[model samples]
Target: MRGGVNMSGWAGFSDEELRRMQRKGAEQRPAESGSCPAPGPRKAASSAPRSRQQLQRERALQQAAQRSRAAGEEALQAGQQLSEPPPERTSPGAPEQTAGPGAPSPRPEVKQSPAAESEESREEAPEVKELDRQEAEEVLRTRLQVLQQQQSLMEEQNRVKKDLLTRTLQLKSQQTQAEAAMLKTVRAELQQLETMATNDISILRGRIEEADWEYSKARKRYERAEAEFVSSKLDLHRKAELKEHLAEHLYAIIQQKELRKARKLEELMLRLALREEEREAGPAVETQLEAENVETVKEADFEKEAGTEEGAGSKKEAESPEL
Candidate 1:
């Protein structure tokens, strides 16, 4: 039973198995290292700080791997001890003797009671139980080591995930900072444009004021010229009215002079008719006619002189300078 237990314990995991597992681990290490590349110089320069929980977890994984390796070593040692031949056993009553290689040693036979046999069997039972327990413990240890290895692998995967998350967050923060800088630049440009626009508006307003002032001045000058023209037109209208009145009064005076000359000639004709009726009155009548004719000619000459004087006065008035 003890040998069976020993064989079973050894069978649970042998040296070959340990070597195979170790070789597998060794082969995977390079691939794992290659898959998870080391940080570059630039990445190292901006390396993020690890959290307390992450550091603690990494430390725990390392401790578990160490423990698993130690357990594997102990199991290997146990298997080696089981594989070695058991030490030679001798009864307390017998003594060790040296024998030549060509001769055989003689042995004594002894009889055993049922009680003695039973006692021996009873003692062997606990030894068998102990071997079985030891085998079970070894099996459990191997299983625990496997579990630990699986746990370590899972921890590595989690670490990689954390690293990726950290890198993504860092990139996002950098992008946000860049955007903020661009926004600041845009705002500055907008402020500069607004300042330039304000300056231009001020300049335009000044020009508009100047134009308005010039327009007001021109309007005033036009108003003054229009007033002077209106006064001149009024003066011309008054002169025209005065000339019409003078022309009408001169025409009336000439008509009255013509009527008076016609009346004087009719009186002279009546005096000639009376002188022909008496011969004694001929010379007196002829002398009176001559006097009348002379008076008529003298009055006509005076009227002509008056008309010439009036014409000269009217001509002088018409040529006079403006007030």
Candidate 2:
């Protein structure tokens, strides 16, 4: 089992998948064993075109290497424990093994001393620790690169959002201005119509009064005369003409007023819709990121405080004398 791979979790996997995973795990063994030379610097994911799966595989490789290293350490420890001398099983009164009369004395014991074995283990520890450190650094580097890329993307998105917001605001302002202008125009037309209506009413009132006077005079003249006079007929015709003119003018003014009011309302509604849309679509991506950044800074400050406390505890322990 020492050199064998654990393919225990291959329940739903095909042979091809199993073989590939095994092959990849094996490829990472040399790095894990600390027999291979140090890995050179690697490219960050941001700088080069790397598939997502490839980066995932690299992370998997590092994890597998770490597991292999841990397993190797466990095996080494087991071997050390096994190497320890077993307890003797002699009876309390039993004698030590005596060399036979003709048997030559056993060669002097030349087994490795405990101190030498410990020293060897100590020497091996650093080598394993160094490999673990390297693997950790590599993993952190990849993660840092991913974070940097994510930050850049977020910044770009924020910039785009800002530009869009600016455009919307400009458009809203333009729409507002247009609506105001149209309102002003409509207001002016309404004022003009009102003035015209006033003038027409005054003119119609004067004409009606004049016609009434004329009709009265015509009736008087007609009454005074034995027969209806021609002059009386002319006054009646003039009165009828004024009434027709007043009615036509009033109808035209009413139509114009209705049309202008409808147009103004439509424009007002359009402007309101635009404003509502702009309001609903939030325009504060940068602000939100800023808040997130503030939270991150606060978290970092807390982490630093914890780290300082840990260091202070370690220092206190170092200063204190052992009992």
Candidate 3:
């Protein structure tokens, strides 16, 4: 019965008392709630230095925030000081009072709290930055469009220049071909002219040869006529000499005939003279003869008578006387 009663008293102890007991136990066991249990004394010393470094970093951030608040309050006070002036008065009939040194200094206007001003500035800054960004984007887009237009214009200009060059070359080639054809035609005309000139020269040479042959024939005929004329003159001179000789011979023959006829007439006159003389001489001779005969007869009779016959003769004489 005594052991049971002691056990109940220990179980019924107060919570505060129990906590005190736990604290005591912790102190005795070398550990606290907010601290790590150290394996040894050296580890506990290392943890204490790390906790001091953390506390110093937190204090630095708090002091920076307080300085920013002080600077913002000073700027607000300076702006308010210049906004308001003291009250003034004017009397009727009195010269208007000019602003003077007697006037009260201006009261500073109340400014907004630091927290409100900071929030407003922050809001305005974001709006200005957005507007600048939009302007820059617009400028970039305009520049890109201008560059594209310039490229298209350059391509069109190149196409136009290429087409012009091609047309010029084609025209030049056509001109060259036309010039060549014209030159060919001129050369052909020149060749034809040369052939005609050669033919004309040959014909002229033939005409000259024919004229030379005719001249030679005419010269031969003239020479033959001249020879005939010379022969006729020589024959005429011979005939004149023959006629002179014949006339001289005929004159000589007529003189010889006249001399012979004169000789014959002289012979006939001599014959007639001879015949007349013979007739006259013949009668005289006859008378002489008769006388002689008478004489002779007488003589003869005388002789006869002288002889015996003389007688007879005398007789005959006598007979005759009788008759």
Candidate 4:
């Protein structure tokens, strides 16, 4: 019984142990089955998807950068292609494109608005701006100098014109004075000529009056001489007639005296003859008587004859001869 009891006990111990073991096994198995496998692969797959998305983003960024570099190169090449060559040199007064040796090439003319110029100036280096300002100041100085020179030239020209005008006025005044003097001299000369003419007229009048008086005196003397000549001729004719009458009267008286003398001579001859005859015949007594008688008769005749002759002679002498 002991053996059986021991064996039963052993079997019972063994069954109990087996039942605990099974329960532990069941618990361990359920526990082991309840714990699932870890989800590492799913996590890894999610992470891989996220990593690919990020790689795609990185490749897009790289492509954009490569395109930007290519465009920048194309722009640089285009800018170089569009740029023009330098312009040719030109002669003075010629077109800008004209070619010439040793001449400066034309530069591009840049026109800027106010805003653009301000921006460019701001962008310029400090040294370059300083140089440009100095150049501008020099240009202003040159312009000022030229203006001063022009003003001086104008003033000089004005002074010269004023001097010429003054000289011209002086010359005109002198000429006027000279003309006035000439007129005065001419007037004086004319006055002198008039005076001389008046004096000459007076002298001529006096000479004419004297000539008239002398002519009147000469005419009167000529008339007097003519009257005297006519009276003298008449007196000479009367004297010639008186002389002829006186000569005729004297011839007649001489003829009468000659006749008386002839008669007396005849009587004396007769008396003498008678006396001679008586003496021849007669005596001496008769001769004495005759002589006495003849004496007495002769005395009486002489006295009477003498008285008659004296009377005749006195009458003839009383008439004087005309011549």
Candidate 5:
């Protein structure tokens, strides 16, 4: 039969009551066994051995608790795995053993020893804290990895944006330069065409002015020539009329000279008859007849000279423009 109390009976007990019960049982064990009066040598020998054994057990338990506490502290600071095994939980139905039958029975108010309960609690507490530290460390590591991945992705996006911006600026600059060159070329061509048109207009205007001057000069020359021709025609008509009048006068003078010649011839015939009759009469009658013949010839020559001068003067007037 087990000489002990049940662990279920210790569940509702306070620590002070349990410790008081343990002291009472320890004091009563030696007296009830009648071994308290053992011979001095034997008692000294047995008590020394028992005291050493109890001290060893107590030191062992304290060392175990300290090691567990230290291990838990180190695990919390460094996130390392626990090397010690997990603590075992005591069942409430299990029995607790006493040293002998002479030991005092426990009081109704006492159930379990305070030292054992404390050792169990001390061992179990570290295990719980270590598990919690491990979970927290795992969560922190996961969050750090996610943050690093996001930073790398953002850097890549920025690089792509910068490259596109640079390309756009280059294309814009090239287009602007091309437009400027095209505009310059067009302006130059327009200026050249305008200059050519101006020159052509100037030449045409000069040619027209020269043509007008030549036409005016020709008209003036034509007018002067016409005036000269009209004056010459009028002079010619006047000269023709003067020539007709001079011809009529010359014909009348010639007829009168011919009649005078016929009359002189008849008078010469009468003088010749008279000369034949007076030839036998005397020499003085012949000399007076010769003198009369010379006087009549002189008168006829003077009249012929006057008529020739008038005819020559009329011919000169008819031929000259001054008439």
Candidate 6:
């Protein structure tokens, strides 16, 4: 989703259309929470990623906030004073709540466990502090997710900024070309001034002064344009260089991650295949091992028989000689 560009839609979009898309993305962005909440959530949305990661994070944060609020209320009911941070922004135009006698009483903080009287209240916290603790953990985890979203969003903004810089450079180049044309016009005017040099001396003097003034203005304009063009060109070069580096690094990282994934998948498949083979061959392997053991036993028995027969025959031959 980080790279899900609508290339077709992009080609068709005018500057105004592109801007509208960017704004629409920003407006549709869910409210941010405890973290930096810096910027570019809207731009991130323009990617139109189906991940729903941001949406899920926002929802988790809302739930955590709700739990925090409930805990505060319960603590308040238990005669424990609690301070609360400002609530995170939600969608616009939330209905207002007015205070009146008709308003419902705050719900009592119900505790599943019995409360110890004076000692627990002395600390100025209710048993629901555990609930608050759990909610804090949830908030921390949500913060991690928000940080990731911000990272991706930051990357997207960088790309957008790069495009803007490229456009600005192009415009600047065009402006410089226009300035060159102006310089040509000024040269033509100087030729006119030279032609007038032979006319009435007083008239020529006036024209000379006019030409000098025009030349000065043109010179200043040219200098300014040249300086601006050089600076912009340098800045554009730096941005492009940095962009290429980032692209290369990101590409390498993606390749590495993909390779790792492929390896893992391969390993898992191999394990599965091996498991199937083992299951199929298990009995046969066991039978072969058993047969080897049986053969060894038989060979041992035959050696024992041969040794006994030779000993008995040698004793009988000795007895026959004695006879």
Model 6, residue 294: distance off in Å is 99
Residue 33, candidate 1: Cα error in Å is: 49
What TM value does model 5 have? 0.36
Query: With candidate 1 superimposed using the best TM-score fit, by how many Å does residue 238's alpha carbon deviate from the native?
Result: 3.1
Off by over 4 Å in 1: 1-151, 257-323
Residue 262 in candidate 2, Cα distance off native in Å: 99
| lDDT at 61, model 4 | 31
Q: lDDT for model 3, please.
A: 0.45
**Cα lDDT, all candidates:** 0.54, 0.50, 0.45, 0.45, 0.53, 0.51
Instruction: State each candidate's clash count.
Output: 0, 0, 2, 0, 0, 1
Query: Candidate 2, residues 1-323: lDDT per residue as tens digits?
Result: 11232322211222343345445445555555755433331223234344642443343343343333333344354553212122122121222332222222212233465677566444333343434454445435534654576679899999999999999999999999999999999999999999999999999999999999999999888787834445456555654665566557556655755675566557545644665566552434444455456556755675576567556655644443321
Residue pairs in collision within model 2: none
Ten-residue stretch with the least lDDT total in model 6 = 2-11
Q: Give model 1's TM-score versus the native structure.
A: 0.39
How high is each candidate's TM-score? 0.39, 0.31, 0.30, 0.30, 0.36, 0.25
Estimate candidate 6's alpha-carbon lDDT, on a 0 to 1 scale. 0.51
lDDT of candidate 5 over 1-323, digit per residue (tens): 11122222111212343344345445544444553333654444355555543443333333323333444344455565445433333322234323222222211222457777676544333333323333234324433544465567778888888898899899999999999999999999999999999999999999999999998998899889887788788777777777677677668767866776667656666666677576754654565567467756866686778678777876676567653
User: Which of the two, 2 or 5, has more TM-score?
Assistant: 5
